[model samples]
Target: MKQLLTLSIVLTCLIVVAWSVSPGSTNAAPEWQSYAPPHWILGPIQGADGSEKIVLNNLDQITRAKIPITAFHFDAPDWQSCTGNLQFRYSDAVLDQMRARNIRGLFWVVPLIGLNCPEYQVALANNYFVKDAQNNVIVTDNFTGHGSWIDYDNPAAVAYWRSLLDSLRARVGNVLGGFYTDSVRPDKRNGVVAYGEAYALDLLDYTRTYVPDGDVVFKRYGVNTPSDAWLNQYAHVAYVNDLPTNFSGMKTGIERVFATTPLMPLPYNEFSGFAKAAPDSETYIRRMHWGAFQPVMENVPFGKQPWDPSFTPQVMQVYRYYAMLHRELEPYLHSYDQAAFEDQTPIFRDMDASRYSARLGNEFFVQYVTDYTPAVQIKLPPGVWINYWNEAEVFKGNRTIMYRAPLGKEPILIARGAIIPMRVYSNLTGHGTGKSEYALTVNVYPIDHSTFRYHDTTNGWLTFDVKGPTRRVALCTLGNVPSEPIIYRIASIAKKPDTVTEQNGAVGINTAWGTPLPERNNKKAVGRNASGWYYETNANRLWVKISTLGTDCPAP
Candidate 1:
């Protein structure tokens, strides 16, 4: 018998575990709100000096492949030099191309001024740099040697830095999406309490003025930052410091970052660490496979393409497959993002972080450990779950099961009775759908009733509720039909439906008593055809398709 813990017990343990880093943190849970990041964010991790030609090349290839990406993060020479000198590369043509492709541009910014830059002179004249005990300018040395950090405690200094950012935005034709604020507190020797707070306030205020919907990401600026709780409310995302390319380091970093969930999910990256040694093709793919299931797939184009160049086709194929898979999961991922915003809960969670156990749960867990001599045991909540990768492998919940997971294929489970809405692939440039088509393929596990809300940037909030063979899908703002011929492909069902009927505010479908598919066996149960409904007796699964365009609705 497996050791079973109640929901309250699990939550209480999570709170206690989370208390290690964030002591005296409030227990007041906030209401969950919806949050969806821009479709994709691409950045170059290694080459900060990347030119427009390089960006254009990537954009062209990604476009041809129809890989979904919405925003580009500019670093190094494109925005500033590694030496902290102002470079600000890129031209009108660059901005125009990004605009044509419907991709927004962003770059890195820090609160440090190079001693040799013209900005330093202006700050020196106006006393904008942080002062020492003797009222002398305090200088710090970093990768970009001998620079003065922003003295945001002074009002005049804040205005000067804000104006500098304003000028950059104007220079870029205002096409930039947002910024990745770097090391707000690069040095702590000054002992300034408002170091990160000052920059965060200005950035948030600027976002509200210009791009209200844009995201602001920060490093070393939030509750995760020791002795700091300032930027937690303003920033949208945070990433752990760069770690080694080895598996243990990556695992430890993930645990640490996800453990500090003051708000939002931590975006995982392996490019920086991997770029140093440029690991073999197998290692690269493994690293990427680990990232594919995370909350946000931060595809930083830093190192050489993960796969060996000799096998370019294979590399591209695998990369494109995972990218598209991530694209296909937007509807599900964004729903959890919203839940995090309003409720202060993270969807990409760990079942137990303090003990360094691999068990993770947020309706599902992905196994990263390769060795399974004794088989990896996972503790699941009380319910039935179907393996997302292999629907045939179903687990009765409230128990621990030792299961072996194969490489490159992580086991993700969908709870029974859960209604997940998915948009079938239309194209890559426009995020799966090429046109304004309201078509969805909803996978319904064996369940009594379940409701899911689809939030689209253009379509707004659409609530979809499914009960048995009946489904209710409606746009919150519009009473009439949002799209013609709305289709629902219900999969992994237990009943065979013969006919489907349309009606006002609802639709009904009945199963047929057809023979199971020929391939239906004990473990592997069902496969559906487009012709009609099909049933698999051994696996107890059925598949059905329903349409609502030409079918007539009866009188209310």
Candidate 2:
């Protein structure tokens, strides 16, 4: 027994040391690659119908309701003057409105030119499209009518495509966030499947120049095949193919998210599905919960608005709760995204093949229930896990347990000794805009020695260190002190500490659990310039407010 225990300790130490020296540990991602928009991207397309009015009204409604959204994705007629024409229809003023709300605009575009589009003749005359064996333009019939696929392999064709996109930029000005490169598949009649990959890759590479830091392309994963691994570099964000609005579709979407994360780190599906009929309230809420935890949370209103009167109020309430939660977790999500880009690690790590669950980096383990039955069996990883919804309810790891997941709640387990960096939820405004200052809240679950390399949007990177022994716990921050204040909430501490000390040798007194620290000149003013700690008896959590106005804590 002693030998096994010593071996385990050595293994744990090695793992910690490895993490401390990993690439993500030493350097922040490049400035351009580190840019992350609000995760809750709203795609307001009701079936095949969408208009500029619909797009603007959806943004207005979401803003009026105080729902969080940072980007609005325009599908079909919203951006196309004639279907498949690479034409910009919405006026620049519409983009101005979006920019005023701090919301970016993503327009749907395709490589095909419909027969009725004026540009079709131009493309055909110039041999810009693929030709059959007889050297005739290969016109294929699709849902949008007959069109010819652009021969992206041809240099002239690619230049013509670039010119069209340039026109869009000139028309829309700078508010264009990116393009949704859908329908890039070439018709089989042309006998060239390789052209589709070129189309997606070239388009993404060129369009990335428009928004150098923002997500430049949202494409379908594996349009060619699952093994087309080269697509990952250009697919800033990828979604599964359109699915039915049913439980089966929900299950398939979850499976695809798990299956594709290895190749495409940022994978998500339309919330509540996008095909067939509208989703029922149960399916919608359940799927929304799953979407909330994914690396990217997107909602496409296929049949009815989430606030429609047909569904129960609980549906909208749950949607609001998860949306707000997703916005608050941007810091946590972006940090892992940086690690994925730098280390090639998946943002959502699959836990079990047979179950619908994944670990969001080392911080969170989430189990998504895909069926009507609320009961679920989950086998946790080795360590202590805390129920995210109810921190008071704890579970021992390396064991299987049947958990009851009632509506509006899913199983989200926070690993013991994990540090999550998040922004204050209440500070968010309409269109998911927030204050300019970097007021952060760090949630720490201290068990043993743990470290988290946290990445912020404005501030580059910071490391959080925590050491929790039998009766003592110490938390400190290292690297790049944030310009704003930080509040640290340390969870799972069973008893009040005898005394808490900061790096400056000032002792922190235990205060009421919910007491708010006073602020002087927008900075936390603890008792006599010494920070303070609070203990919550019910959850066994401690709260500490450290003001990093002009100084940061020394390394622990």
- What are the TM-scores, per candidate, against the unseen true structure? 0.74, 0.82
lDDT of 1 by residue, 470-526 (tens): 332221112233242233445454544444433432444552322222322211111
Please list the residue runs of candidate 1 whose C-alpha ends up more than 4 Å from where it truly belongs after superposition: 1-49, 76-78, 81-87, 144-146, 184-193, 220-228, 265-275, 307-315, 354-363, 370-381, 400-407, 426-441, 453-463, 469-486, 493-496, 511-556
Winner by lDDT: 2
Query: Weakest 10 consecutive residues, lDDT, candidate 1?
Result: 1-10
Supply the global lDDT for candidate 2: 0.64
lDDT of 2 by residue, 1-556 (tens): 0111111112112111112212223122222233344343322211223776766677666777666666677765447787666677766666777778777667767677788889889988899987778988888776534788777557787778778878877777666667665544435623343555566555555655565544644445434422224444334467786788888888888887776665545777777687648888988999888878888777776667787788888888888778777777777887887766555577877556478887888889988888888778998888889888788788999889999998888788998788888765453321111332245677887766888998755776777777654556556666766655666767766886655555432113332122233332221232124345556566676656655332233332
Which regions of candidate 2 fall more than 4 Å away from where they truly are? 1-49, 91-93, 189-191, 218-227, 427-437, 469-472, 493-541, 549-556
How many clashes would you count in candidate 2?
A: 0
Q: Ten consecutive residues with minimal summed lDDT in candidate 2?
A: 1-10
Hey, what RMSD does candidate 1 come out at? 9.5
